[model samples]
Target: MTTEAETLARTVLSVENLSAWYAESKVLHGISFDVREGELLTLIGRNGAGKTTTLRSIMGIVKKRTGSITFNGDQLIGRRIYEIARKGIGYCPEERAIFSSLSVKENLTLPPVLQSGGMGDEELLEAFPNLRSRASSQGTKLSGGEQQMLAIARILRTGSRFLLLDEPSEGLAPVVVKEIGELILRLKARGFTIILVEQNLRFAKRVADRHVVVENGKVVDILSAAQLDSDMERVQSYLGV
Candidate 1:
């Protein structure tokens, strides 16, 4: 059952006219979007188009950022990174950072105990059965796709309501990609709100409820899944995918 906190959720994550800089270099211009309850939103664009930076800014990892970012009705402009995480936002970067020396179970349990309503290892194992099989293996021993699955699954232990996933389909075999796509859909069906940053149009087309196209550091268009299903050419021209 979806709680009032999840429903009437209006917007779990909202960014308005956001901008960011690394030292003197401006990376993101004024970009804005919203992730509603249980929605699977995605950001797509070319390399260097500021997709990753946008996620980093939302997580408060950027050196400097400006504009209004609100999570669950609280202003996030000046919050620390962990503070933001505590507000129920989990981020998985493109690199899939895992502890190479630790076993899969250990890596999953390493994060600070969360205070919100995300998934646990047992539940995540049910969501990704392959993870259950590899639970005792060292992180380095897993294949690339397994590592990616572990990385995203581990973030669930943080108890986040909103997940920001970066290029989750990158560099995986088609079979692995298909599995990842299914994991994302199952997450959505379970009422987890996700904002995925993807370059793979096929993967995004499968999972996204809505699509936001970013170009030259700004969101240029917003399209529904229905729109994408009806017209791939329009989306492809914006993304060159």
Candidate 2:
């Protein structure tokens, strides 16, 4: 009984009653949300509010998790980390996690392509011109911005349709942050869906289509960009900004 419009507007990812823990301490408490295909959604909150934990749980990185995480109609809760990844979800942790020992080229080419339609090395280099210049340099030798760029660009080669980016703009120079923002916009234009964990509200406002506010390990609010603009006072109160 699904209408054509509803089918066209189907969610690419869905999480319901999702809870996670580190050892014995529960971090996320029944967090739930949906991400439409090609939408840019952001998780924003004060420190230790479980924004990153949600992303990790979605990627199966946080093994001690409960509830449902479905992607394109497939259940992901019990899947292995690699199994989940091969289902076309790419993760860029807050740490960037570039291989310190590998050259930029090597790091960029390392991940095996998990699906069709991934960008080739040349295409990725063209998209991130600075990476082309640092091709021969070790990952550790790159600037903070370049390292973050490498972290994101490396995943594009995997043909991932969904991207979980954790604090991508954290600790970067303003100019570098602007560049990363532009890059994200570009990726969105190419029909990629993204879930971002951003501490910089200003930056998130510029790139995200919608915002999900998390507090005390739960999704406390969901707002469209327009709603956020009009209700920023309430949003700021929730974020304790």
Candidate 3:
């Protein structure tokens, strides 16, 4: 049996010396990491540690950025957001960006399907059973978990196999968080490569294969599930958990 670390899958996303800024303020300072095909990797850090900026930079949402972010041998630098999305990478931002005026079904189907294999509305709704019952309700009518599910489902419709998920478990009830975790695992089972940004280490450990530790916009360490287990105390001390 092949292990998660022993898999021969090629590197799906390679990031090297990545840096980005918000106006005059520089955030990421040459952060670097690589994710393999079908692997679930997490960027774990405290608030304002540039985890979200890293995701934005990958999607070309952070305009003033430098360094190489390659997906399947395609360079992501200088690409437009639409171009990136169309290149088979989906991004689910931390804030559930569902339109308040739109119904749940509307929000789920809003993003254009970027490729041939993108999941349809029916498939996504089926995967997120909570969304099925509330399909006709306005975005504001749903709970936090439902909104998060809607955000993730919206991206799946785009047919981007590589996903950059930002804090999918944030501000949710325990049961809801567990549901989200199960959903992520299901997606992983379907062969989607995922890069997750998370503050919840416990949650991250549950779903992630490996973790890249970020501090002040730089990658300080990378830990596997076993390493993270043995070093839990040290990791938590630095994370301020």
Candidate 4:
């Protein structure tokens, strides 16, 4: 039997009737979901299905949105992006926007205040040993996989509880994709809540416990990983994978 405290602590994020628009062009259409603490939830969709927009809206980056978004029991609506981030939310965009000229260490060192107690290098290094080898290398000097690893590693360093990872598996080799999948599971084991947006079905299945499918900017379906696998046709129909 789970205790009341345990049940209460399990919920980390809640999105209720969330909507977004870019200068009168409405994108997301009243999508909603709940992210339980320590669970890896993946938003599976094709391009322009509002996956990235959802992440941005949660981060308060949309500039114009409606409905309720509560993180860790606090109302996220009307909060600034920095304030949202400070409350343990981290957003990794699809572009892998690392400072081209800044070295790995320098990139991680700047914009240092994300969590209350900063994270130690050992924790992130343990997650990705490859990063430690190229710690001194310039951001633009690293390969695609290395850059992706660094992007995530930088987020971890911020001690964020909820990670909005956008397309971490995009444009990486199979081995690197596997490594990222492992990294997601490891992060989940450490009690971090992750909202991963990915088009890679196999990679998403490997880590996501629950699945949310978006179509035409709305959450059309939600299922467990098993349900998604068993009903591949349904997933493929909406995801068009």
Q: TM-score of the candidate numbered 4?
A: 0.93
List ranges where model 2 is wrong by over 4 Å.
1-8
- The full ranking of all candidates by lDDT, starting with the best, is 2, 3, 1, 4
Quote the positional error of residue 209 for candidate 1 in Å.
Answer: 0.8
Q: For this target, which candidate reaches the highest TM-score against the unseen true structure?
A: 2
Error of 1 at 207 (Å): 0.9
Per-residue lDDT of model 2, residues 10-103, tens digit only: 6999999999999999999999999988889999999999999999999999999999999999999989999999999999999999998899
Per-residue alpha-carbon lDDT of model 4 for 29-63, expressed as tens digits?
A: 99999988887899989899999999999999898
Reference-based lDDT, residue 117, model 1: 67
Report residue 100 deviation for candidate 3 (angstroms).
1.8
Q: What is the C-alpha local distance difference test score of each model?
A: 0.88, 0.94, 0.91, 0.86
TM-score of candidate 1 to 2 decimals: 0.92
Candidate 1 local accuracy as lDDT?
0.88
Model 2 gets an lDDT of 0.94
lDDT at residue 27 of model 3 (Cα atoms): 99
CA shift of 116, model 1, Å: 4.8
True-structure Cα RMSD, model 2: 2.6
Reference-based TM-score, model 2: 0.96
